[model samples]
Target: MGIITGGTRQGHEPELTGVVIRSSAGHLLVAVDGTIWRCQMRGRLKRGKRQSQTVAVVGDRVRIGAQDPHAEPPRGVLEEVLPRTNRISRMAARRTGGHVEQVLMANLDQVVAVQSIAEPRPQTGFVDRLLVAAERFGVAGVLVLNKADLPEPADQKTMWDYFVSMGYKVLRTSAETGQGGPQLADLLKDRVSLLIGASGVGKSSLLNLVEPGLRLRVGEVTGKTGLGRHTTTSTELFPLAGGGFIADSPGIRGFDPWAIAPRDVRDYFPDFAEPQQACRFRTCLHRDEPVCGVKEAVAKGRIPRWRLAAYLSLLGDLEERAERLGPRKRP
Candidate 1:
């Protein structure tokens, strides 16, 4: 889509273009110049067929009609949404049936998967899914192990090392003592990054440490559930003092990747790339397949067994989803 500058369109009132900093309940907070305008999407934009479940999300560039001078709190209409360079998305259940693509963030430079060392414990399954999604969407992925002040289990340490060996940058951070704060800050500096993880993983706390001025509200894990309480109700972008912007989203309990076919699941698992090539069958899912290189690597200790387990779990989910949805029709 071509850029739409602030000017008259076919003799109608002039329009203003800006980046969408936050979106909720069909309302968008667009940053036009230095001011933020509260706007609603145009009817036409909502009526058209869309690839993502959300019409517009945080980090989307949009065009809005000029705000009315007499409007009480400054409101406008979002006339058009600019094409996104890229988007990170997941599968969301549709009320009617099946699943839909839910875009988490658009035009992001990287995706940071945050997990804590202890307290609530780390869910490597969640981290793996995020990393796979990042790979599928063509975005850089960083894994942050928060709560560095706490003691880490031997197995966790081994997994961390394995992640590094797989070519993923893993940083150990502590929101309390500022451990690895500088490295995290440097990674997020001058870039549009999206922070995602389960609740109580210290996503907000780490951001507060990186940029104290933010003063974002922090939540604690429930004593009974040992899960983080939802602190961030909506996704919003905050400008960093060091340059660029960071988006803090509501904590996710689970992640289901969207639009990934069962056969294509192996492509997202980078560790399987080298090993799967040696499989007897070119179309190997790496599960129950004879002479699978991936399985052989696991047996030989070349690849971690946990990684294969995670891949099989995700593959099963995709296979089930595809079966329920039936064969996808070619457009």
Candidate 2:
């Protein structure tokens, strides 16, 4: 029902509060009470000078005007977006002029970075990058190794031990056998967590198993490329039966965190932060530097060599991005 206003003044109309459940190019579905209203954002929200590609993403709280009662499914006008506590984003592919931030999901308390032990094979680099992005965005990161029903690879146990030693929560899940569903549910309960991974990693399958009502479409890995087909086209949030909300995002092919300075990359990697303090130079990047504590740790087998390589790979990417985009101005 539309709120009747006595006068034409803007303050006369009553506003309704809701949370955004899904967003596309120009429209969004906001859930208020039990009704889902399709809304169009105000011009001001879209016209402001900003770096983010989208004005509002799923999990964003917003205030909307009353909806037309007679409209088929009901529609409302978006007025204002409430402040977000935290969000996960990446630097969008470079354009002709500059780079823009692609906000994936907003207001997430934790991010579950999913990877498979088989089928599509594990991409450690991708997993490492996602965790770093989560750390940079101020959201807790959890590593989930799915498809545990299959035979465990030789290096899988070692990889698990490495992450566990670094103080990260790691879970081995098997959607087919229900191996780690309870633990996964416990971690996700009462928290706003987002699922992120490459295609064919069983993100949809895992969600279906955890929350049976969600019949999310699951895709298989392409036989030729050994890559996953895009099953999720857009971001959507689902309320778990027990408590909390889970947002499932489309599988990402590449992820580069936004606004990362080359010199500050080490901070995003938690394991590197402490060892870096003991380095010979105050500005040591742990690469090509003499008397490096990080290097010594790697040599002594404290830190996995693959992990160091992942960090260096990300460092190179950040440096190249910085060169292309120039120094970032404080916001």
Question: Which prediction has the highest lDDT against the true structure?
Answer: 1
User: 1-331 in candidate 2: lDDT tens per residue?
Assistant: 1122222327644567788889998799888776788999888888867888888889888888765735766788888778988888887766623367888888889999998888888886887888888887789999999999988867888987888998899999998899999999999999989999999999999999899999999999899999899989999988899898899999887778876777888898888877777899998998999999898889998889999999999899888777776665421
After superposition on all CA atoms, what RMSD does each candidate show versus the true structure?
2.3, 3.2
Q: Ten-residue segment with the worst summed lDDT in candidate 1?
A: 91-100
Best by TM-score: 1
- In order, candidate lDDTs are 0.86, 0.84
Pairs with backbone N, CA or C atoms under 3 Å apart (clashes), candidate 2: none
Candidates' TM-scores? 0.94, 0.93
Q: What is the TM-score (0 to 1) of candidate 1?
A: 0.94
* Tens-digit per-residue lDDT, 1-331, candidate 1: 1134668778565788888889987899888776778898888878866666789999999988865735655688988888888888887764524456788999999999999998789985888888888888789999999998999999999998998998999999999999999999999999999999889999999999999999999999999988999899989998899988999999997887876787998999888899899999999899998999999999999998899999889988877777777786211
- Candidate 1 residue 283 C-alpha distance from true site, Å: 0.4
With a 3 Å backbone cut-off (N, CA, C), the pairs that clash in candidate 1 are none
- Flag regions of model 2 displaced more than 4 Å: 1-13, 69-72, 95-98, 328-331
